[model samples]
Target: MMDKMILKRLMNDHKNIAILLDVLAKKNHKLSEGEAVNFALIRDVVEYMQVYAEHSHHPLEDITYDYFVKKFSSPCNQQLHEEHSSLAESSGALMYSLNLILSDVVISREKLISDLKAYVEMQKAHMQYEESELFPLFAKQLETDDWDKIKLQCEQRLVDDPLFSDTGDNIFEDLKEHIEAG
Candidate 1:
């Protein structure tokens, strides 16, 4: 299953996003309990989603999804693509709220937590849909040539994950420690 590696990488990316979502949820919990929420950390998480995940992960999947739709006439592509598009808008809202908090504005904690929860849940559900439905369908439908095209597209657009890269900044180090300590 040569195409499986690509799917696996996508799955790992999903897992990584889940890691960030977990931290976000925890922060929300802390906020609910009257503890200070780290708006900077929340901003970083949203930034990672915007910069790395959106730039690299979604484009790769869009290429693959487009291929699948064209080659196999699947109807699943549109919903997944729409979800991908909505991610940016939803994340932007989350970032907007976080920015308000960061700037010492008096945004409601309830609204911030609500937005974070909604964003995290939406991301998790989208990843699960791809993993459960789309990946298997692709494995059944795609040929070597199709996968080759995908590989080439991925190579052409490389976006290194700043938090997970060897050359990554230590900005996420505290987040990583929190993840490990949990």
Candidate 2:
């Protein structure tokens, strides 16, 4: 039983990630003239996806999925788990390709774009699945104690990467400011 607060926080983080994905997708499509597909910004996006998004966020979902699987023998848990695996695999492959391109190896920009597109699409679909199917189920099923446990696990497992340490601070501050302004 995941905490409602934890689920809410996870959903908020997912929204932030979706925004970043949109920004990356737009920026990627508008690659500067003569700029490699694996530009610095592209690397940053891939790093965030690999470290912050996949590494941190997915583990929480994995725990939630585990609980659901144990609680219900329905097909939903199995399908969601499969979707999670697919998203992780696709995102990891895309990150690897981006790293290769960043390693000074000449690669086709088209291929990089293709991989990125696929990754983004997969992520978008996965997010929708979580929001539409998984989140509501969690909210209904998880007790406060379950949520507290999940929160503790999330905090303990949090990765302290440069992206999270540096960029996250400013981004979240800005978000706070924006919310306050409104």
TM-scores for every candidate against the unseen true structure: 0.89, 0.75
Residues 145-166 of candidate 2: C-alpha lDDT, one tens digit per residue: 7777767767765554433344
**Tens-digit per-residue lDDT, 1-182, candidate 1:** 35555666777788888888888888888987889777887888898899888888888888888877877776654787899899989998988888887888888888887888889889989988988888888788787777877777677656666777667678678766666777
Provide the RMSD of all predictions against the true structure, rounded to 1 decimal.
2.1, 4.9
Which one wins on lDDT? Answer: 1
Model 1 spans with C-alpha error above 4 angstroms: 1-3
**How high is the lDDT of residue 72 in model 1?**
74
What's the CA error at residue 41 for candidate 2, in Å?
0.8
Instruction: Report the alpha-carbon TM-score of model 1 versus the true structure.
Output: 0.89
lDDT against true structure, model 2: 0.68
Number of clashes found in candidate 1: 0
Clashes of each: 0, 2
